[model samples]
Target chain A: MTYCVGLKLDRGLVFASDTRTNAGLDNISTFKKLQVWEAPGDRVITLLSSGNLAITQAVISLLNEQIRSSADTSRTLMTVETMFQAARLIGSAVREVRKIDGEALEANADNFSVTFILGGQIKGEEPRLFQVYSAGNFIEVGEDTPYLQIGEHKYGKPILDRVTRTDMRLGEAAKLVLLSFDSTLRSNLSVGMPMDLLLYNADSFTADRQLRIEKDDPYFQKLSQDWSDALRDSFASMDELEV
Target chain B: MTYCVGLKLDRGLVFASDTRTNAGLDNISTFKKLQVWEAPGDRVITLLSSGNLAITQAVISLLNEQIRSSADTSRTLMTVETMFQAARLIGSAVREVRKIDGEALEANADNFSVTFILGGQIKGEEPRLFQVYSAGNFIEVGEDTPYLQIGEHKYGKPILDRVTRTDMRLGEAAKLVLLSFDSTLRSNLSVGMPMDLLLYNADSFTADRQLRIEKDDPYFQKLSQDWSDALRDSFASMDELEV
Candidate 1:
């Protein structure tokens, strides 16, 4: 039970992920689901993961190991030549974790599940966002639908379907994204706060505009309260079915 | 593969069910998911069902047979003194269907699944609402929630969560209910149009106010279009997150 959404706007990419993970209702804890790899002026790759925490953390650790290893400077995410290559590298990392743990998890009737949102830029290419699956396959955001979401997605989806466009301003899109989170958080208990939010400006090649939203974050509180009031007002304004 | 919602409001109850049912992507068909049994001035009961069409149809057929026979003079829905008894009758009908088909379905690796929302009243009781599960257990709507939904419910739930209360006007609540369906219809392929919608008034004990919304229904079209515009306008009014 997690919710992470990434929007590929005309400006850049906006990524947000909740911090709650639970093995069951009673065993809940906070964990970072957003992983960032930035090599200033060269590449900026961001990932938001969901599903079995152990698998996601393992996949992230494995990717970090490759970056730390002196043996493979040619092909870590930081060295990937393009955003497409970075997505492929993430796919391989997931498959690597699956190879090691999928069988044991299956025997226990626990799914060997994990999914990721991979977004950012590598020099010479435009900013791109992709959703990578548990099977190590992926789909990229297209202009017609310039956003992707994973985990507890349905409650937040209708708003995105209605409003998301490729040309939205980064701040405007961030506002919509948080409203989406507001819908999800209100409906689902498993997806809780403080969320990690990052707004990437295309071609910046740096991940500096990131914020962590706590439960009491004043701006989010105001936005959430305002959206609720607006929805009620809007609902009241609609003509009731008269037939 | 279906969406049905039943809301218990101050006035009475509201029920809406999509007509689409599918066995697979290639084998989809339109079927009536809302069943109404009314003996004008005696009782008015509406049942909205979801899950294996076979099971639900079988359950309804069994209940109809009992009413048609001269044998069950005391306990048919028309004769039941309270809405609670009517709910129990529906649950027993479900269990009878399972007794006959459960093992066969399980042998074929199919689930013996069906759920229903039963809402209405008999002569002696106030309007009531209940959700009957596959195992013949049921839950009555309390004042705290006052509504129940089954099948592809998440996309439609947030709006209900935000706006539903025990004291809403029947027409206002009906507007909210149809808007909930609009959200589901936009996101899910298996829930489609020509929906059966019924609104009951307390103490009337007659089923009237029922309307079938065809795909080309002008009022529905206007409502759907208006909702989208209203949402976009509402989004515009909300302040953007500045952090």
Candidate 2:
């Protein structure tokens, strides 16, 4: 299981994902779920994926292979004219991978499943966000719904519903995402630390701020401890229900 | 969809349930999910159920019929000697209902599904709480897990996970449950207002503090608004994550 969130704010976009993956209780591993593609001064695309590791990894590799070979540069994410086209390119990759592996996975009672949150900016377009499903279809974030989440989303959703807004500052939005992750990590064993965080400023055309938060990352530790303390304090201060 | 919670605290037990029931988006209704069976100076048993309304309503009616007939008092919840026996009686009621209606429901592609949280104090035993499944098997709440929730549970779970304790005061516990419900109500359209809340003090043998909070209840309105304000305040106070 995994938890990934992508937010489109007035300033830019923020993406965060946990690294833990488990096949069974006894077989757990760490894998990075955030992938970044950038052509400085031109475009920046970020992808956060969850679900079947093999499918997500295959999709990422396919996209990377296209970028490395520089074959048909016009069709790659780096050269996509808009964030929507980039999402379509990713969706197509998902479908192409499913075509090759879907039947075998079904025969073994495994699902050829993967979901992704794609967000970024092209040189001429505004930063946008999308949630792509296992079926290779996707929905872009709207003005009222400024964020998208996939995998183990319910536990972390209340905080985002309460605190996230289009006008929130980039730093504040980053804080909200980390708090959301903290709630999910505490509630679900399948989601753990060593998180990847990327903050993009609107029209920057580059991911200037990216960090990998490890188990001992001081800021995350402080944020987790402080948020817990703050929640308890808030709870304590509320008046008892009168009945 | 529904949302119901049962908490086992040292002082007694607490149960809260939303009253929304729906067959589809176009077919929604309000039905009480909390039921209490009490024999003053003897026992007080409260049941909170979630799942297919037909199955749950049938189970409740069967139990009520047994109470009305009084032909088998020894086997009824009213005459049960222990809380465990009360849970067993309720479980039997569930299985019996399934025996009668399960096949027809399955033929219609409907699940004869119902789950319950049974909590109360019988004359000779300590207060207890149990979660009964569709198969009529049940598990009791333990010291570590002092709460059980059913239906749309994930959105409201993080708060209970953070604040509930076996030794917490009943007033504080009530506050916690309401906040948990508030979170669920905000995130899910399927779970709505006109909630039922019941608090049972150990050895009381009667539920004297049961309240039905309607949409216009002043206290609930205050609590909901105050909780939202407190949470936003808490979020604002947290230091932004340094990028």
Candidate 3:
């Protein structure tokens, strides 16, 4: 299991994904799940993946392979004209991996489930966030629901449901995303960190505000501690149940 | 789908269960998942069920049928010697339902998955809490982890993890449990109101302190609104992310 969240605020798109991957309890290891493709001022795309590591890595490799060949610019992540087209390219990449490996995985009772969060900007269109399903179908975040999360999502969702808005500033959205991670990390063991954080300012068309927060990052530690204390206080302030 | 929680606090046990039952997104209705059996001053036992409504209702009916027979008091919930024995009785009831319906459900490609949280006090012993599984096995909660939840649990779990304590007063625990429900009802469609809440003080040996909170219950409406506001404020109080 893993946890990754992408927020499409008016100011920008903010994304975060944990680095932990495990087959069993004892076989845990750190692996980066966030990938970025940049054509400098032309386009910037951020992708975060969760589910079967082999499948996600294969999809990423196929994507990178397409980028390197450059023979079909329309199909490459770096050259896709719109975020919608880029999403379709990813969907095709997933189906390509499925056509290769889905059956054997099914026979072995190994799941081929993989999901991706793709969010970023092209020159003309605004920043957009999408949640791509294992079936390769996808849905975009909109004003009403400006955030999307994949993998181990329920534990951290309440805070996002309450605090997130499309007009939120990029920094404030980043804080909300980290707070979301804080709740997830405390309750679930499958999603561990040092986390990969990416902040793309809307219309900037560049991936400049990115940070890799180590497990012991002081700011995260302080934020987590403060959030916990504040949450408890808020809980305590509620009226006592008369019944 | 349903959401039921049982907390074993030093003061006693608190149980809450939503009344929603659904076959799918469109076929949803109300059904109580909380059951109680009491022998006045002798013992008080509360049961919360989650999973297939058919299996749970059958299990409850089986338990009630046994209670009605009364020829063998030792095998009945009212005559159970200890809380552990009471848990065993419920587990056996689950198995009885499985024996009757498991194969038929399997043939239809339907699942027989069901779970239960049992908590309360019997005479001559301290309060005890056990989570009974479909396979007639159960595990008790201890001091370290003082609460058990089943069915659609994760969305509301973080708050329970952060604030629940064995020494919490019954009223305080009830408040926390409601806050947990507030989170669940907001995020999940399968779990809804009206909710059945049961609070049992330690060694009370009677089934009392029960409340059925209707969908339009004023207190619950106020609590939910207050919690939403307090939570947002708590989140806002956190520092802006440096990144």
lDDT of 2 by residue, A74-168 (tens): 57886678888888999999999999999999999998889999999888888989999999999999899899999999999999998888998
Which is better, 2 or 3, measured by DockQ?
3
I-RMSD for candidate 2: 1.3
lDDT of 1 by residue, A1-243 (tens): 899999998889999999999989999999999999999999899999999999999999999999999877569887889889999999999999999999999999999889999999999999999999999999998877888999999999999999887888888998999989999999899999999999999989999999999999988999888878878888898888875
Off by over 4 Å in 2: A71-74
TM-scores for all predictions: 0.98, 0.97, 0.97
With a 3 Å backbone cut-off (N, CA, C), the pairs that clash in candidate 3 are: none
lDDT of each: 0.91, 0.90, 0.90
Residue-wise C-alpha lDDT for candidate 1, range B198-238, written one tens digit per residue: 98989888888989999998878888888889889988887
**TM-scores, chain A, per candidate:** 0.97, 0.97, 0.97
Q: What's the distance in Å from true for residue A181, model 1?
A: 0.7
Residue A137 in model 1: lDDT: 95
Best by lDDT: 1
What's the ranking of the predictions by TM-score, best on top? 1, 3, 2
Q: Which stretches of candidate 3 lie over 4 Å from their true place?
A: A70-74
